[model samples]
Target: MTFAAITGWGAAMPPNVLSNADLSTFLDTNDEWITSRTGMKERRISHVGATEMATLAAKRALACAGVDAKDVDLIVFGSCSPDEQVPNSASGVQVAIGATRAASMDLNTACTSFLYSLSTANAMIRTGVVRTAIVIGVEHISPYMDWGNRNVAVLFGDGCAAVVVQATDKEEGLLGEQLGCVADARHTLRVRGMGSGYTNSGVMLGDTEWDFDGQEIFKRAVQGMVQASQAVMQKCGVTPDDIDLVVPHQANLRIIEAVVQRAGLPMDKVMLTVQRYGNMSAATVPVALNDALVEGRVKPGALILMPAFGAGLTMCSHLVRWGDRVTPIATIPDEMPASKLSALDLVNKIRDRKSQSHEASHDGLQGARLIGAK
Candidate 1:
């Protein structure tokens, strides 16, 4: 039987960091409060677009896998913040990397996007429809962020990571997965002014108002992830003790702890990045996976559990069995361009522009029935 193995992995993180102290300068929040509540000391603000970051990350992944761009047959771009909606972000990555022979598609399940993309590629590879694919989990959320609202604003950042998967005779990669969505609680974490539903409704683009019920989201996220984790492990006929590491969605420290605890896993086996990067939404799990590799935490022949939840109220857990190699075959010398602006400066500029263009119409969008509540 043919299996899909994760042969390459790379991450792109912006240089500009928006610290909690920086956030306190504008929002009615402090470092202690933000850190204690969300375990976020800082988050990245991208100087470039999401597409650029994804492309750079893909190149690195390709190099790591020692695979040429021409050999890739599929490219899956996973993100909620696309540089453009019409052309699709996957095509942009394909073009940037000169993967002229690959079929490009976009996938978004908010924070669970990467896991979903991984599953999609895994199935296609196993079915012999494709040989090599690049699955990217990326988010450039700073531009679309509702900076005026500390509730959501402080909880997200910008990042990207891509993994190269290829068909192999070895039974590695995704062994089992569970995917579900809590539609009833979807409105608890809605971002207004993003979709066509709000077009020409006096809701300016990038002028967003979040309808976030933190308590409700927290409760649902934990419950959904735990259930998915349990089911995926059971399906694979393995207990939590069989897993070597847990790389969970870094939405919040509390949520991660709650899910792991309920799954009967220990904290030492968990890989965490929330304190540094917050929630990069779709980018969270993949970036954490990359970090674990760099830290030498992912051993050869290890079994890894990834559980994540996203904005759709979407939830998923993936069971991955590692191959004999944990190190990259090659390395790419590419990196994101340096930023001239500080993270705080970038955020302030976005806030200022949004305030100027959207302040008057903000009320209309904020109170819209379709978005539920502000």
Candidate 2:
């Protein structure tokens, strides 16, 4: 069996941060209440675009992997906040990063997206179909959030993270995985808009409303993740004691604590980033993975368990072994062009085409009016 190693990893959060106090100015909530509940004092916001954030993340990951964009064979993007309804987000990323030769696509299993992408990438690598792959988890949750309502409004932020997975002959790296979904509870948490189910009926015409069941989602998230984690641990033939690190999704501190307790793992073994960056949806896992690597918390041959749970009633866990042999990529020069060609540029190009079409339609209407007058 071909081993899949995480050769590189990187994350990107927007410069502008929305603090709890800032949220209170717009929504009816105080800093103490928000922090005590979610342990998120601030979260990143992407003013440019979700595609921009995702591209930035992919660039960094590619750099860390010591690989050029041209070297990537596949691109799998997991996202809940896609910039467009058509033309999958991964296509935009592939063009943005200059991975012209790579096959690209997107997947959405709510917050479990990154794990889902990892699983897919691992399978492709094991099947001897691809050598180098990039898996990114990005979210622009601010767009889907209901600012008027404090319940769900304060729980999200924008960010993106990417990991470079490469095929190796080593035995370590991505040892086991477990994925589960509760379709009957899909409606427990969701943003009902801009999809085929809503758009085909014209019910979501220009509407961007986010409907959620906060209590139910919170309960399910805790229970589902704990169960998934246990199953993954068993599959890997290891107990909680054998785990060197537990990187649960950065949804809420409370949820993380609950999962740790249920798993009978020490709190110190778990990594937390929600305080610095709020629930970044699918980006949460990769962000934490990058942080752990930077902090020297992960060591070669260490066993790491990553469990992610999200809005689709989705829960996934990946058991990965830290391998010693990893390629190190050189850093990009500081003088690199600021006007970088990116996926966001590609999106703007598409938008420009749409605008030209509208203008042409208007000109045609004017010509018809002139003929009628004559």
Candidate 3:
């Protein structure tokens, strides 16, 4: 039977680190408070667009596979922060990497994007549609971030990661997965002033407002992830003891701990990036996956578990069997362009632009103070 194997992985993380101290400059939050609540110390702020990060990650992933971009059959860019809605972000990576013959498309289920993209590519490859594919999970959340909203402002960071999947007869790659969404709770986490609904509504494009019901989101996220993890494991006929490593979404340290406890998985077996990168929305899981391999946690023929929740209240879990290789065949030397501004400066600049763009809502957009009240 044909299966899709993960052959290579790469991550493109930004250089500028936004510390909790930097957030304290404008809000009431400090390192101790933020860390205790979310298990986050710092997160990256990108100077470049999402596609630029995506392109660099794609190049590294292709090089790691020892497969030239020209030979790639598909490029699946999973992200919510597209550079432009018309051209599509996947096409940007395709052009940048010169994947001349590859079919490219974008996929977004928010935080579950990478896993969903992996499942999509795996199905296509297994069905004999595409042979080699690059799947990416990336986000540039800083631009539209409501920097004054302490609730969410401290939880997100900018990052990108990609993995190469190819056809194999081996019993590796994704064995089973569970995907679902809670439409009823979707309203609990909505971003105002982003889509066509806010196009001409006295609100500028980047002047976003957030409706983040942390309490409700916490309950739903924990429940959804735990249930999905259990369902996927049951479907694959594997117990929590059979999972070698768990690479879960980095939303909150508390949420992760809860899911691990409820799913009967030990904390030591899970890979976490929330303490450093915060919740990068779609970038969390893939970045954590790459980090796990780098840390020598993944072994040949090992079973891996990945569970994630996203903005749509979308939830999913994937079970994968690792192949023999964990290290990359070749590591690309290319890096994302360096940033001139510090993390705080970059964030303040965004706030400056946002305030100037919408003077009427300037005070309201200061952070959660204004938006949360709305």
Worst 10 residues of 2 by lDDT: 365-374
lDDT of each: 0.91, 0.78, 0.89
Clashing pairs in 1: none
Which structure among the candidates has the greatest lDDT?
1
lDDT of model 2 at position 32: 98
Off by over 4 Å in 3: 358-374
Q: Model 3: per-residue lDDT, tens digit, 203-226?
A: 777889889999999999999999
Off by over 4 Å in 1: 358-374
Candidate 2 to native Cα RMSD, angstroms: 7.8
lDDT (10s digit) by residue, model 1, range 1-374: 99999999999998889999999899999999998898899899997888888988999999989999999999999999877786788988888899989999999899999999999999999999999999999999887899989888899999999999999999999999999999988899888989989998888777888899999999999999999999999999999889999999999999999999999999999999999999999999999999999999999999999999998899999999998988989997888887777888888778877867656334332111121122
Model 1, residue 189: distance off in Å is 0.9
- The TM-score between candidate 2 and the true structure equals 0.87
Provide the TM-score for each candidate, comma-separated: 0.95, 0.87, 0.95
Predicted structure 3, TM vs. truth: 0.95
- Candidate 1 local lDDT, residue 372: 12
**Candidate 2: residue pairs that collide:** 66-329
Worst window of 10 by summed lDDT in candidate 1: 365-374
Candidate 3 has an lDDT of: 0.89
